[model samples]
Target: MTTLLSVQDLAVARGLRTLEGVSFALAEGQAIILRGPNGLGKTTLLRTLAGLQPVAAGQVVHEPSALAYAGHADGLKSALSVTENLRFWAGVFGRTEVGPAIERMNLSNLAARPAHMLSAGQKRRLGLARLLVTGRKVWLLDEPTVSLDTQSVALFAGVLRDHLGAGGAALIATHIDLGLPEGRILDLTPFRADPARKAPRGDGPVGFNEAFA
Candidate 1:
């Protein structure tokens, strides 16, 4: 399989607190489960890989627009209906199909409901649905199973499997089991930064390669 992303001797900083060394490569159709104790930079690592945050050092190489990220904050407009929210994401990702994504997440029945009216689980379902329209080759998800019921989690696992089947790779930072027994686990604990380090000078713009370093 083709390599989708490569990370070499990465150092991700959270306000001058640099994380421990990190290095890994994601090949097409592969999935890596990020495992580590809280405060060990699991979320930081995901944000870095998503390009939402910058890396302090090391190199991250991938094709432009090849990544899609879902973080702790569900990027949704409360006033928008479920369908409208998905429509907006589809437009942003240059995709024309919103029905399949909605259906995939089992949100068809809630399509007309305002986002604010949905329960926590429903909102999470919607968040996961957004990933479908991006057409990105790599998925960087942080705690994707949060608020999802068992059935919803199953659905998510199925979606992930399908993505891999289509040659997409994922780096998921989650504490819960996503039902991917074949997925590899990446422990971030070994790369945890020292607490005594001084804070960095300035916060940089968040992006794919620049997030964690």
Candidate 2:
């Protein structure tokens, strides 16, 4: 039940678009579902949490070894086999074991298959499997179920449950219901940037404010 991450009054921005007034704390074994309409900065928020991008303001506090991120783009090498990709990530993350992760993802049979040869669902599964190799405490996931089927989605849910069962937390930005047994939902609509403030011309797409304005 320890707090793994704390984001206080955070503001995440992309070009002229900004999402402000964000605050949340993620505890061990807890999951937070980030729910918001498109272009409300859900992805941007995840990026900010992952430290892959800068936050315009406020504070993000988390241990360096406690965070792992999985974005829309699966971090996989197309030229490598499934095992090879996992092995590479294991090496990068300084994890000595890869067998359990492969088994956990149900990718044992496809171990020798090149990533490019796998179907979309299989590839997505592999992408998710990489999260386990890092052994990080907090997972920042963006649309983790993009191309998964019913079975694959179920597998993912089980994986998430197991991760939580092991005292790891996740912040998932997804529109689909993941069927997690326990978690909290965080809606970001209230955090939309001020409408009165004009953004630079063509800085980004019109958001909640501009659409109404």
User: Can you write out model 1's per-residue Cα lDDT over 135-204, one digit (the tens) per residue?
Assistant: 9989998888899999999999999999998999999988778777558998877777777875456645
Give a tens-digit lDDT track for model 2, residues 113-141. Answer: 99999999999999999998998989888
lDDT against true structure, model 2: 0.84
Query: lDDT per model, in order?
Result: 0.84, 0.84
Q: For every model in order, what is the number of clashing pairs?
A: 13, 0
Maximum-TM-score candidate: 1
Alpha-carbon lDDT of model 1: 0.84
Clash list (residue pairs), candidate 2? none
Model 1 lDDT, residue 194, Cα: 75
